[model samples]
Target: MTATVHTLQANRAPSLEPMMALTTSGMNAVNAVILDRMQSKVALIPELAGHLIAGGGKRMRPMLTLASAALFDYPGTRHHKLAAAVEFIHTATLLHDDVVDGSGLRRGRRTANIIWGNPSSVLVGDFLFSRAFELMVEDGSLKVLKILSSASAIIAEGEVDQLTAQRRIDTDEDHYLQIIAAKTAALFAAACRIAPVVAEAGEEAEDALDTYGRNLGIAFQLVDDAIDYSSDSATMGKGVGDDFRDGKMTLPVILAYARGTDGDRDFWRSAISGDRVADEDLARAIDLVRSTGALADTLERARIYARRAVDSLGSFPAGKAKSAMIEAAEFAVARAY
Candidate 1:
């Protein structure tokens, strides 16, 4: 097996296509459920939710649900609805996050909050949460319910924790890691773990998948943080300096600030304190992250987590399912390029 941490040379990076191909039929089913469940008599509910749903977001979490079931060669369609539920939970978070962050762009388009206003965006997010729970209850598995519901709660707590830590120059890497594990990785873990439950593949399998998802989720977020400084909006699908402008204390910022000169530290403090948000300041911030090796180090850290994610699958049988999942982890870190 190829180690998941090799530097992704140009044109040799991993692709999500294999995973997408692996889960095609299942994803089609999941998509139908997503489209069907997002509907409501209230025109705005679907309208607002549909804006983000149709916004070219890669349904990665739900696809993980489908892919993990494939790992067991489970031949049931029950995962379709559950996968849809996972996506609903994810979409709900994105909606609420945009509102909370006052974000203007997502996936290269205006956010729902920007288009429809925060109140509608928030209420629609609440509606999606209701739909996610309804799907879970309809699944009729207490174990699945507990896993997803707990993840949802943890995600909420993580968001609150992030809100509290937002823009604080004193926020450390360990605290940042805890926040991402809950806010981001919790759903990823629940999405994969539920596969074994519906397949009745036992607790050991569940634990393995949980670890895979959690680590992959961390890698994914770390890459996103690095991309904010290194990639353009065309690549990132949002403003290149959005995190900087928002005063987000992502790993790249944390590391750069930690490794900065006295002058650089003062600049970071002012930048993160919202005192220096002009485009030139953003250019300087990007330079500091790169000059301090924070960007490269953050990506290396992502590769570390991605490797763990791939290793967690060692217990599973080897085949396209396992290979695709492994490549998915590679793709998570490779996206930075």
Candidate 2:
């Protein structure tokens, strides 16, 4: 009769510094590709794209690509362009997401959509997507192209599905899982999957990395959802109550709703329906999630997925790359702590 403990001590928490250090040189190359390709005759495209691209994102997707490639000890630079393409795709999605979410802040800075207006943000997002495709094509790998292109389409479909589910209290945990798998995990899978393709590491390695990325992505989003209720805007890099105000059916809200009293449910209904967005409602919402153990449980769920992600790398040789990747997963789940 063993209990699963998911929380990390503050002094003993995992960090991304190892992964960042491992991919430093490769990421420099990818960043160059990103900057050069983002240039366009239309000034507005570069301006809007640069705003979010240069924003303080962790660039985790592209970093995964580079680190996965390093797992194979890949000597060539073929992954640099592909990793840049992954970042372009990710950045484009963020731009469009800010517009769709009507968000005001990201990475503790003003979102491009808020600063440049929605139309400009959306069109610039399209431009970045086009640039991503161009990079993918220039790489001349049909397999890589297929993987990333399909991921892009799946991400779009997921976004639409999430839009349909938005503001709907009936959205369950399984349904929410499906939406995040597509919207978030799809790209993550592709990013790590492309690494094996470029390294000629065969399908088995590709599958393993895909599993790692997909599970890590799910865990990452779970912590983010939990953080929305447990953390502040400065800590989360966006408005703290943005999800509640947007009526996002994240796991915390879902779990809390499922476990809540009738009165609590009524309060959630009102809060999620856009009727109660004041500070007190947010405080009450936080209280409900905490009292119901929804936040703690969400972090626990993230820990499970993070462990799966780490276990998926068992086939790979143990080295710095493997250690860094494992630490990265730990870091993902530990962020909420």
lDDT values for all models: 0.92, 0.92
- What's the CA RMSD of model 2 in angstroms? 3.5
Q: Which residues of candidate 2, in runs, are more than 4 Å off?
A: 1-11
Candidate 1, superposed: residue stretches over 4 Å from native: 1-11
**TM-scores of the models, in the order given:** 0.96, 0.96
Candidate 2: tens digits of C-alpha lDDT, residues 125-178: 898899899998988999999999999999999999999999899999999999
Candidate 1: residue pairs that collide: none
Tell me the TM-score of model 1. Answer: 0.96
Can you write out model 1's per-residue Cα lDDT over 1-337, one digit (the tens) per residue? 3323333347766989889999998898899999999999999999999999999989999999999999999999989999999999999999999999999999989999999999999899999999999999998999999999999999999999999998899999999999999999999999999999999999999999999999999999999989999746677788789889999999999999999999999999999989999989999999999999999999999999999999899877677888889989999987788
Query: lDDT winner among the candidates?
Result: 1
Q: Give the TM-score of candidate 2.
A: 0.96
